[model samples]
Target: MSRQVSKKAIRDSKRTFGNQIIFWMFKILYIIYYMLV
Candidate 1:
C-alpha cells in the first residue's frame, strides 16, 4: 500500500514538472513573439 502511494506521488510530481516546463516554454515564446512584433 505504501509503495503504491509513493508511486502515485512520483507520477504526480513528474506530471506537474512537465506541465511547468511546457508553461514556461510557451511564456518565453510569447514574450519573444511580442518583442518581434
Candidate 2:
C-alpha cells in the first residue's frame, strides 16, 4: 500500500514538472511573438 502511494506521488510530480516545462516554453514563445510585433 505504501509503495503504491509513493508511486502515485512520483507520477504526479513528473506530470507537474512536465507541465511547468511546457508553460515556460509557451511563455518564451509569447515573448518572442510580442517582440516581433
Candidate 3:
C-alpha cells in the first residue's frame, strides 16, 4: 500500500511538472506573438 501511494505521488508530480512546462511555453509564445504584432 505504501509503495502504491508513493508511485501515485510520483506520477502526480510528473503530471504537474509537465503542466508547468506547458504553461511556461504558452506564456513565452504569447509574449513573442505580441512582440511580432
Q: Write down the lDDT of every candidate, Cα atoms only.
A: 1.00, 1.00, 1.00
Candidate 1 residue lDDT tens string, 1-37: 9999999999999999999999999999999999999
Candidate 1, superposed: residue stretches over 4 Å from native: none
CA shift at 33, candidate 1, in angstroms? 0.4
Per-residue lDDT of model 3, residues 1-37, tens digit only: 9999999999999999999999999999999999999
Which portions of model 2 miss their true places by more than 4 Å?
none
lDDT score of residue 3 within candidate 1: 100
RMSD to the true structure for each prediction, in A, is: 0.6, 0.7, 0.7
Window of ten residues with lowest summed lDDT in model 3: 1-10
lDDT of 3 at 23: 100
